[model samples]
Target: MFGDIMGMMGKLKETQKKVQETKERLNTVLIDEQSSDGLLKVTLTANREIKSIHIDDSLLQDKEQLEDYLVLTLNKAIEKATNVNETELAAVAKEGMPNIPGMDAFMK
Candidate 1:
């Protein structure tokens, strides 16, 4: 029993390490989103950090319109980034998890 516990502990530690590595790797994965009219664009990392924003000159003339476009585009970009981040981390975590009978359900 103690041996099994020790093995599981090791696996948990390894999984933690892999999770951290995956998070670091996500920083390099980029996601781009733009407004429906293509006048506003936003880029984000899979880690959900905003990388850049590009707005058309026309948008600069209408502050309210620009804010609306930014909010919408940024939200979409953030959603995409969150999905990527979760999927990648979940894959790594599931792969590294030890065969603990009930844990499979939780992973799913």
Candidate 2:
């Protein structure tokens, strides 16, 4: 029993290191979106950090239009980021697991 415990501890440490590395990589994931008319663009990381936004000069004269485009573009970018973030995080979660011979049965 003691030997098994020690072995499990070693695996746990390796899993922790993998999870940390995966978390760091997760922060690097990014997604960008643009308006259909090409007047507005928004970029954001999977962690929800806004990287940048670009707007065409023509949209600046109309406050309402610009605001509309901003909302639309931001929503699109956020949606994409959310989808990508979830997928990436799920992959990391899978990675964090050590493939034990019988652990799958236990997990189920």
Candidate 3:
């Protein structure tokens, strides 16, 4: 029983290291989103860090429109990034997790 516990501890440590590495890798994964008319565009990492924003010249003329576009576009970009981040991290975690009884349901 002690041997089993020790092996599980070692596996958990390895999993922790892999999770950190996966998070770092996610920083390089980019997610792009644009307005329906393509007037506004955004880029963000899977880490949800804003990388860039591109606005059309027409959007500059109307502050309210610009704000609306920014809100909508950025929200979409963030949503996509969050999905990617969660999915990737979950996959890494699930893959590395030790097969503990009753933990499978929680992981899902």
Q: On residues 13-95, what C-alpha lDDT tens digit does candidate 2 reach at each position?
A: 87777767766775788787899988898888877789999999999999999999999889888888888777766666565
Q: Give the higher-TM-score candidate: 1 or 3.
A: 1
Lowest summed lDDT window (length 10), candidate 2: 89-98
Instruction: Show model 1 residue runs off by greater than 4 Å.
Output: none
Clashing pairs in 3: none
Q: Model 1: what TM-score?
A: 0.94
Give a tens-digit lDDT track for model 3, residues 46-81: 999999999999999999999999999999999999
lDDT of each: 0.94, 0.80, 0.93
- lDDT value for model 1: 0.94
In the range 1-108, model 1's lDDT, one tens digit per residue, is: 999999899989999999999999999999999999999999999999999999999999999989999989999999999999999999998988877789988987
TM-score of 3: 0.93
Q: Residue 9 of model 1: what lDDT? A: 91
Which residue pairs collide in model 2, if any?
none
Off by over 4 Å in 3: none
- Ranking under lDDT, best-scoring first? 1, 3, 2
TM-score of each: 0.94, 0.71, 0.93
